[model samples]
Target chain A: MDAKVSTKPHEMLAATLSQEMAAVNALIRTRMASEHAPRIPEVTAHLVEAGGKRLRPMLTLAAARLCGYQGEDHVKLAATVEFIHTATLLHDDVVDESGQRRGRPTANLLWDNKSSVLVGDYLFARSFQLMVETGSLRVLDILANAAATIAEGEVLQMTAASDLRTDESVYLQVVRGKTAALFSAATEVGGVIAGVPEAQVRALFEYGDALGIAFQIADDLLDYQGDAKATGKNVGDDFRERKLTLPVIKAVAQATDEERAFWVRTIEKGKQAEGDLEQALALMEKYGTLAATRADAHAWAEKARTALELLPNHEIRTMLSDLADYVVARLS
Target chain B: MDAKVSTKPHEMLAATLSQEMAAVNALIRTRMASEHAPRIPEVTAHLVEAGGKRLRPMLTLAAARLCGYQGEDHVKLAATVEFIHTATLLHDDVVDESGQRRGRPTANLLWDNKSSVLVGDYLFARSFQLMVETGSLRVLDILANAAATIAEGEVLQMTAASDLRTDESVYLQVVRGKTAALFSAATEVGGVIAGVPEAQVRALFEYGDALGIAFQIADDLLDYQGDAKATGKNVGDDFRERKLTLPVIKAVAQATDEERAFWVRTIEKGKQAEGDLEQALALMEKYGTLAATRADAHAWAEKARTALELLPNHEIRTMLSDLADYVVARLS
Candidate 1:
């Protein structure tokens, strides 16, 4: 840890890669423009400018910098990662029928679903173009596959999200496809562009993959108990939406006949009523599912930390490891 | 035109590259599947198995073969083109709120908009992965830009479709963006994979571009006057949809004040009433707008045919040139 700074791990990583992050931000602005379609830039600017941590792009930049890279392709790769992340966020809002994101009205709600869908497609194309400029077919292969995996994960979630029969394994698969795939690709491409050693590149990929899984697990858990002011997400939103995240899945697996009927009435039939959210939390606590889910998140975070040992020792690597801890730490 | 056979140009092109077309179809079938997300293939199969002619992939194969490409990469490139085309069609159905496609229910209608959007995205990602496997960065650059242009065109059409002030130039830009971009990419990548000279590649691109424009124009005109049984489209469908196609643009240019009010009510304000279609047709007849629109289609078809003369002498070349003529000849 940096004793002189009170910054969190993600904020510390962003500060360390501030110059590269600035380049990525600028490139995102430059590339999202359309000569004929002004709505594209308008819609994109609303979401892209609605500030988040830019964690995915920072991972790319940090991996490259930690590998002692001196070339400029890392900037392009960082922007590519951000574009892919942003594109998914756009489409996810449309698929989830979400109204709010990052404490603001989502692009879909403000503009329209058509704008969100088309602009998301535009960003995907822009990301591919950016990656192709890197001239590494290997990098293209990784990102392209990541994109497919991300979409596949989303499709799986569509079928698997609300169904009471969806198991923990399916939930894990969905998370890996939608969340970790991009994280690994983002970090792997960074190392590949820097011409890092195979071992280090694989390490970066592992670090990102585990960190993303832990991060998602924590996020899902937080949705039930998190301070809405801190997370900017309304607790019980997923329950209201009938999403079968890990905690609910764990609780459902242990449910009695009566409790199962409650799940069916609420999640499957969408017959939610007042006090249902409280009852759902009571069931989760009855089965100790929240504690179990938190344990899984910690395990994934520890795996992420352990993966960093394969990389060459660096300050960025330390930050990445702590970032993993910070992911699960929020829930605790 | 070939003197011996009684087949149309597209059929001739397909027959010549039958094996390659089969391979492309098989590759599409294989690649569209997701082990975890069976919904991806299920949705894609609804469109892929809809029995529409594999025109775009055939163009890729024909161009590659005409340029004497004796490699397997063309098959991959052809599948890439088809996937991209299919992906766009899925998204287009959602954006246009279209129910029917090729006389069958669209993927969006058969499933849901979420399936259409996410599966279209999956196919797009799969297309990029296919193109990347070709190991040609130039091809990636071309296809990626084309994808962006296609999305931009769709966005433009969303705004331009209802506005009476949208001119022919804007309509042409939309046509180029939505349809011609993919056609040009399909043919350009074909010749590019063959390692053809820059001039021949340019010729292939021009041929695809002009042919796509002609094909779209003919289809639009067909919606006004052609046999709905043959075209699988209702007469005046675009009019009812408030689309500002070429014929409407032409008539609107020559509209009298009363006629302008009619268009403003029907198209701009979307206060369409009965007898609007008959009056619109009579207005077009008064202004010779359909004839003018037909002339534009024929001009583009001729431009396409002329561009093919720059390619080497081959049977496939004859079929492609004839394909240009056939694109407009259907309207007659």
Candidate 2:
């Protein structure tokens, strides 16, 4: 097939589901407005309309459409997913004291941290309201569990981010909490709302879980080896922040005594000298951790593609399969 | 009837519902624990096990028992109400930059703002899960709406707390959002779980709403006039903080042109001299706003008592009625 060079897979998914995405957008706008608190819509609009890919909501829409859903509730669920995502971003900025997000001033910077925290809360309540409107106890259960996992994952990451004792298992748990939990919940609810069979729902969940892990792994890898222009982040940003992502976790697992001392000084103690970033990169390369990390991303992407085979083949399905590949395609 | 000076009305309610309150406490402790994130419990325990009045959850338990609820779900709902209350308190401390709560170091102060924010979110999500377990859509709706109201009220208060245009209605709206929404939801969900008559359910909501308003007004009133030793706060903390509570709102409304300038300088611009608190108090006295505000508290408390007339007369109901009067009993 001849490729359209300008368009991405998510863009194709958006084109195919433009009508439903529009409904989701409209619902998001309407729901984000506060009758009393005008500050709500301002902060929410800044994040929601910041040209985010809307990838999570599209997963919901795509999975539902793939399962032959014709109902309007999928739109509500999509909006719910996006609201949850936006709420977290607002709080994440506050937690991280981030000044920029998606190449714009974060809500915490534009407004006060108080506004960011409370408005993030308002979005969370709004998301809960949206999910409750679905009238599906099963959907509520999934989303609520996802919410807990996401929160727990965040707390774990906060405590574990710089700890050298954080192994691969702990890293994966944090990854799932911060990223994959929502992705899987987003897709799982799509199949759930469509009343798909148990096996199909499980498959949908596997697809999203694998896809999100791959997405996050690729993101972390890109922090070290990615083009700054394409990734919109400088090389070694995560290393500078002292975050122990997959590549570092992999390298740390095989560090020598001297190397361990270096990890402790830089990551645990947060004492960095000049050339630390280069040294960290060299260590990862010495252990082939970055390449191994890239292989892990591709492996997860493969799992995501394989999971899609359980569902009916359609235009959306094909795009979703390609989207998985696209998430890891930048790794090289 | 002879008065028991040893116990407060809430204490009496606690004595009457001891078994159920134990269950609620247990559920809270059990649910607040995170298998992965130790920080979750550390932050939550700092606030939850802090000697808070637990008055909101007691409202849930009292209302449930007052309506003769037999099931165990009320405990879960009561825990859910407390979780929501605790979650808000955690966020509130962050929003307020509070150093202390319940006369102890606040969770935000004890931990970083990140832990407070994320743990508060964990509790909120846990509350959502507990409510979902109830399987009552109506119950979930009340709590969701309450959560939204609570957040909106905080946002509204953030913007309107110092604005001179804030009037009695806006004060009431802010009060309802921050205080009464949970109180009413606490009670409403109780009656809901009991399958009580709609009239009784409405009465439960009305009782809680009025009681919460009266409770907040009395607290605010006490801030200006109560014993600092008993209230654990210095007089004029609100005025010092430039908060536009009921007393300040009333005084601002009746202020003359020169007095309006005083308010704009003091509350709006947050400029205060040594005598500003004295001057503010004098303005309230000049307009009889303190007396008038006391009257409003009494009126709301009376409304709370009147609402209870529709509920069945039981030990819990009587205690609840007295609880309404007890809220305003602090006023001179």
Candidate 3:
């Protein structure tokens, strides 16, 4: 939980992506600022300045550079990816009624739901404009597909929440739609716009897919066991919201009748009280669901590493592999 | 308010667009029906099946065909536009906290804010995917810009809702962003994708723009003067919301000290009760604001007709001209 270890992975990625990240930041700032509507800049700057990890756009820039893209369009595309990611986060916070995000008040909390919804929409439009500026219909196709997948994932999560019957397959699909779809699209489109061979493009997509999946699973696992200070989120926050994440889904699958009764009461019926968090954690521990989820994350990280083999061995590719490992390394 | 007059203008455009509209409907039904998320279909079907005029997407299809397009991509694009419109309406109702839309319970009323937000997002993603299928970056540009404009309009409306200082220029900007932008883009892209000449493309955009402006002004005028049963919306709804629509904005500008105080108490201070609606209408009539709004709509309709002069004479063009007249004729 020390700052030293916590900052290492992001710092390493920052070192690798310094120039591209700067460009992406500049583009985001420029595009998000609207002169006609002062409200836009106000709402967007709050979240944009809050300082996210910028992982999705980094994947885009890294993938494009690794694929030998020599053009400037990658910068625009990277910004587009970031805008889409930010827009989704804004709307997600509103949907979840989340107050805090990344150690700051969410846009919805800071402003209002109206601003969050409209500004999120503005970012979506700006992202589309950025993609069109690339003049690559294929890029639009990939990113638009990613957008749909992300929305579908969100809807799936909404419907699956508090539903005990949701299993690993459904959980995986939701995770892929919500998290990995954008990651895969970001990397895949980089290779795509560079006109990389189909096989290698597919490989880049697979790499991103595995990495994103691992990243989300790791975060879900951390909800049970992570130090709250390191994650900047409350432990069992998902549990409080009755979210049937991977760990809970797995745990529910193995629950006894008594345990099932507890879940139905706490999650479905929303009867949580003072001891519910501890009780949920105890149940997860008893079932070894946290460990199982961590195992899944490690397996995905390995699969991501394997996917990189299809790419030419380069510094970026190696770093991407390390990043994949780093994503799940916290559980250790 | 009679069916004879109400349906005349839309009838021709509707018939011309019937086949494409059916395809758009099918696309919406299929995409919105998710296997993993039953709520997606449930909420979406509520709005999609609601009896909207489908005017926006019809403009898209008509623009394409009038330009002599032989390809089927326009159908997908039309569906994309409709989906975006529907998605916005779903979210808008939530933000506005409205109880009804199209004479039925709003999606948020039937489901909840969470479902409305998530499903609206699903439709947005579906829209992007549909547009990408058209394989035209130009089309993406037009629609993306429209999306941003729409969001900005919504945000502008949100902040400017109770502020009496919001003037004619600001009101027009809001209308342009909220309504005309999409209308123009819907029609503009139709011609662009069909490879129409630049002059004609501009003409189509102008035609749609003027028509949208006319349509919005007519709607605003009707809110003060039209029959509630015929419009399927409450009379003086804008007045109740303190929204700075054209009539209100203009009336505010020309108000005496006494009238201004009335507005300040009722609108800015939210002190109005049920009886205030009649008094507000009386003030609007005394100052001729209602007539002024109708004149604006008539002027825009004329401009819309004028824009069509750029296009070669054809049956579709004639129908479009009549449609412009029909949009404003409702105010009478």
Candidate 4:
């Protein structure tokens, strides 16, 4: 435990906050069961026990503790966060027709699309029940908005996919809706439920927002430069899927006539062929878009770090700041 | 309006509650939209404006008025109920792989599964936001449980399919989880938000539970017997799908060896052949289960009617009682 505490931001926070996370895990286990539908627990257990880092919920616990909350609601709120995230992941896998997640077969692959969609919904409803238990209207408002925004972002991506003109503005909007909204809500609710000052709550929200954007940008960048072993994803999977991530979007914006024709044939039309991925990589290098996307991620990480200064000085504060650095550190 | 009020229970309720229903309609129209994801509204409008009777929302509005609610929160609650109902229909169409609804193509058939699932999710999140706006924790608890129950019911149905061992108890449990739970929630929240007495709230819950069960049983029976034009569904669609609804469950229990072979060949093995739907229908008649199922629906309808006697009487009370009768009246 001592060796791990100094190794990673989230792991250190988890080690420091083990007891509360245990309570959150227990709450998640208890609430996920149904008297009539035993299938729910089976599907949920497949995903929840898939050995995720539980980073978002830990953020909630860490934020609440750092803000001096000596109460119990944070556990419920953290569980809510995890449930919402897990629900979206389930639905997302179905939507993406994904076969694997985190080096294992996705829930949709194991069961079916019907199970994934309905079980995702069950978890979402379960999440609302959890947040309501927190008894904070402000917390409800944050999470509710986050949920809507997450759906909206996903829908936006659906409409925007395979289109050449989806710009950076739209890309950021999608990121905010799909990824950052929950992050901000998870952190904001921690401060809000703790009855922290409004400025601190706002600071927490900003910190989460920037951190999530950085995390997503870093992820998109890693899809291009990341190791299949380290990231547990085949490199160029997004390219193969024709997804319009940041690196590709940047490369598209800078494409010459020949390059634009290549993208249109390969991406817009999805007529990808042998050596096309290599050609796409060559064009990206020509545009230096990988470096540019990496820079953008670094800047967002810096923004996240800056926002942490507004938070009250505490041990968790250092962890959160380090967490921001760790998000971009993945790119390095 | 006067002409309409005397024609049917739903028409009567609509005529009596037109003004308030208008507000609920307006709220639904405004809230189902998204500035970011216009597809949200497009998909919702396809389902919401398809001209089905807004029965669940009417239950909320009717229960509120019967309980002497003169405030506006009922509109939010009613809208919440409709959003939840609509959200479920969208997801249900996808799960059932249904092509049509209320004589119109389903949103899943018209758009795509991703839009249906994500838009359904957006509507659910919007429902939670609407319910939260009512400022009633009791209402939240009731509806959240209903949402969870709905998903659980659907998942239960998925697991219970193609299995001959699924009995009447499981059928009723599925009915309660999927249909009656929402109906009960719609009425219970109406009373709870009005600050009505606990007994009245319990009565409303009982009324909705019975009504929804009756309504579902009636629907299953209709699928076998009703005119295709009147029901907007081809007769025996459930049989074709090999779904083990209540009507078939009852018949299967009393099946002779020869009848069991037919069921195994058609339903369990799904090796459906010519005259199989007709054969299934003939077997149902031979066992007298259709009439027996109809009798069960009437009993539930009568139970719904009986539950209303505990409520303080109002004009809408009569409409609700008649609505219970009308739910099963279609079977005749």
Candidate 5:
């Protein structure tokens, strides 16, 4: 992975993000400590200390540094954003009833669903407290809006699950809500807190949104064909759950009458038998849906790179652009 | 009820709460509207329009007003606190798999559990946004602490569920988190935002905390003997669930060897069957557990009344004292 990003074009970008991410991680650890309840520390540490890439907080830190912020509040803001992201994940695993996340047993799986829900709530409260310390109403506004958008997105995804009629438009809305809203807000609030120009703020939001969308699209694409060991998720899990992901949706759009009946039974109604996985894989193959999904991810990555044109030519800007590309390059 | 309030001091307290609560209801409806998402309005209206009593927010308003606050932010603060309370209720229903709230179908039951969780999250985000607009870090501190306390209380409750060994300390910690933290924070922030003296703010917090503890204990007591029509909850519901409520805890503490064995079999081993409710009721009566629980509630109510000494006497203060009395009067 380091070798891939160490090429002349990507190395500088990766280096900047790596430095900023270290600062974000330190801030996360500092804010997650609680004086009142031992369980608060234990539960939050279980998730925060799990060693996933601090992607969301790094977005905030990078956006703030890129916008020429010199203050320390950005560090706190970045941590706040990360806490919210982690809190959502803790709750999401319980809601999805998944057993694993990032190759480890989910907090819910290890502690119980109740702990996941309550501890998630604790992190959310902690996040709000961290943001409030910044004392910027605009920062709070952007983050609170992001939080609501994230929730709305999750709700949309839940409603869309198992519904075969779920189209690209709804899927896009769900992805934007669940994934992109926070990414955009994470970066946007960094700019807002730093009192950046409104146009630059817009650019930052656009950059983050496009990057997050691409990242999620890549994740969905990988779900179909990526190595299970690398991704930390079982292959065909989405298919088994009958999730109407992009690949499945694209294939369904191009299915014949007989194929449509097969999907209606297997995906929509969830009446799959032993041989259904093979049939599903064959259908995805015939329509080249996975390839199409990868192409869509690349398209979004390119759009993210295009948004960076509005930023001044700085090392951070260059790295952000490379990061966008790196998000999709994993597929290639 | 109106006639009774005119004739009885306890009834007068409820009437005062009712009037104060109306203002809270109006504010909640006004704040919940979002111009961007029609779905937010649709989902929020389902719960906001469900006719809750608005007790928590009223506590904030009454606490502030009684403490000589002459500011307008208390209204927003009251509304924000209520939104947080409502959001938790929405999520809790999903977590507990509960079907009913306030004698009506829950949002999770009426819509979907996903909607309940996500919409609840939206409301929570919105609440934080509202608090930030108040520009008081003290208010934020009070509320943020409350949120964590609430979540911690919930996790404790979940851990204690079905474990008959859950003692009074664990039960009190759970009750404080689940119920008293918000009640205290609502009042504490009310005073803090109003720029009340620090001493008065502490007193208000004590008042609310004691009142909340008393309120919860009263409700638990009522669950064993409340009128089905008035409480809108089925009698012996907690018994059926084998909840380690105060009555059960006290009863177990006073149980004979044979009675202890029976409780261990039914509550700990989960061997509840038909006629277990009557047997449990008999045990509670024999041990005077219900009376002991009522005594505890009365003591808390007295403590709440004592906290009001810091505030100047007013009609609202008098009403608050009466409210404290009324909370315990329900046990009779």
Candidate 6:
């Protein structure tokens, strides 16, 4: 294989950890089953089999392997991470009243909001059960705290997503809760289960956190400039929905009176016209806010790579470093 | 002093465990607060202060005290139980689109479904954090299973509520999931945290399980017969919603072809008219299904009292025994 032949870091991680990934898949399948409520497996299988990149679980696997973990508990923890991610997706669809997820009809839309709510709840419980099976109280504590942060972030986002006063700081808090908390927990638990030093665990957490922040920033930016078909989201979807992402917040911060009126009419008041998305893009361009947002994403990705310096230098570590770069590489 | 003049068993337990319950209340207030998202506390305070009987947490406290527990972890666990219950109610209101709970406007109605769903999630996460603080894997395992059971039961009820084929055993499973799972977990964890013997823990589980079943059956019975002012629910609300409770299930089982058609149209098709509730009640009465359902609730209450015989004779135990009877007392 030539070095110039590029492959995605996550794909490489998945290939390298195929056996353990298989085990995680098996565990998810077995645990997601409800002997009485068959609807659980139906809803879960729809999302689980929707071919998500399984990036979060793979992060756990890579972190554990990088730390030279030889135990089976990493597989359980990986499944737990995936389950938590899936559960959040299910609930997010309901909360957002979303019609599409991962390029398919959302569970909430396909079934009813009730199934989505209840089945999402079942997945959360299943995730809890999977973590308990690891028999590591430390892992439980990390995940529990992550869950609280995730939920708190979601509530914050619901209240602040459209508020004109929501600045970059509030946006970061929401991103940390809705996205990075689980990522950090996933990696942190992997290292803790491997019985690594507290320093290495902390490093793993930082790596995951910075990586997750980068990932979300890139995603929010992509909503404006990326291919709708590739991203499974339409351009201006966030603006149409009145979501205040970092790019928009940055632009709004520098807005003049007329610009502020535009934001107030389209975002705060949700009164959009045919050219609102185009006007929003023009405002962002005028302020170079998208470029600024992309820079922030690159900075976080670099921070993620920097966090890996304290960990053992291994092949998995190389992949994780590349994974951080890969997240921001989408912008290019 | 005036047992006949009417202090409820829960009220008695509340009075006896007043100091501890107050501590649990304080802990609930402290934990339910979100530093970042003020909306969380706003929604939580609305429900937490809505004066739910706090029956679930009371069960945990009573069980712990009855087992002579001297530690403060039970207070934490009791708060955990209440948080879980409150979270479930928030989600239930969203799932059911309920407007009223405990005779007050529901959080889902007061806020939006999004707020209720997210805040409910925050509470679940908060509950998970509280349980992890206990540092006992067994308690975590019990609560995890109970949460899964509760979620599964909700899904099962969603699928099976209108299906006439839903039999007694299925109803029992749903009851165990929606109501008994938490009750049993609440009591069982209390015993587990108290470092009580396995036999005592098992007895506590049985007591809570039977009590929950009787409580649910009696509540279902009351939906048709209890006073609206007392039960906070209109008579025939279940029939209007086309829920197939024990009384309706029994009547459906014994219905003639014409009656089966009536159920198929009213319950399954949900084309209920004004007289449908009356007709359904007449059928239940004609077959004595109401009487049989009352008998079943009484039997479960008796079983709850019987389970207490295996435990030590404490004042809390007597209240628990009376508590079981009080759950079914509404039938009289």
Best by lDDT: 6
Q: Answer with 5 or 6, whichever has the higher lDDT.
A: 6
Tens-digit lDDT track of model 3 for A1-332: 23453345556667777888998899889998876688899988888888878888888888988999998888999999888888999999988888988778898988899888888888988998899888988888888888878888888888887788888999998999889999999999889888899999999999999999999999888887889989877788888888889888887898999999999999888899999889888998998888888899999999999999999888888788889889999889
lDDT at residue B303 of model 3 (Cα atoms): 98
lDDT of 6 at A3: 48
What stretches of model 4 exceed 4 Å from their correct place?
A: A1-6, A254-259, A273-275, B1-6, B255-262, B273-283
Winner on lDDT (4 vs 6): 6
Instruction: Report, to 2 decimal places, the DockQ of model 6.
Output: 0.89
CA displacement after TM-score superposition, residue A232 of candidate 3 (Å): 3.4
Angstrom error of the Cα, residue A106, model 1: value is 2.1
lDDT of 6 by residue, B65-141 (tens): 99999999999999999999999999999999998887789988888999999999999999999999999999999
Model 6 stretches astray by more than 4 angstroms: A1-6, B1-6
Please provide, for model 4 over A34-92, each residue's C-alpha lDDT reduced to its tens digit, 9 standing for 90 to 100.
88778799989999999799988998998899899989999999999999999999999
DockQ for every model comes to 0.79, 0.85, 0.77, 0.76, 0.44, 0.89
Q: List the residue pairs that clash in candidate 3.
A: none
Q: What does the lDDT read for residue A111 in candidate 5?
A: 76
Global lDDT for candidate 3? Answer: 0.87
Output the number of the DockQ-best candidate.
Answer: 6
What's the TM-score of chain B for every model shown? Answer: 0.96, 0.97, 0.94, 0.96, 0.92, 0.97
Q: Please give the lDDT score for candidate 6.
A: 0.93
Best by TM-score: 2
Q: Which stretches of candidate 5 lie over 4 Å from their true place?
A: A1-46, A68-71, A161-168, A223-240, A245-296, A309-313, B1-46, B64-72, B110-112, B161-169, B223-242, B247-292
lDDT values for all models? 0.91, 0.92, 0.87, 0.90, 0.82, 0.93
User: Model 5: clashing residue pairs?
Assistant: A13-A319
For candidate 6 chain B, which ten residues in a row score worst on lDDT?
Answer: B1-10
For each candidate in turn, the TM-score is 0.95, 0.98, 0.94, 0.95, 0.83, 0.96
Clashes of 2: 0
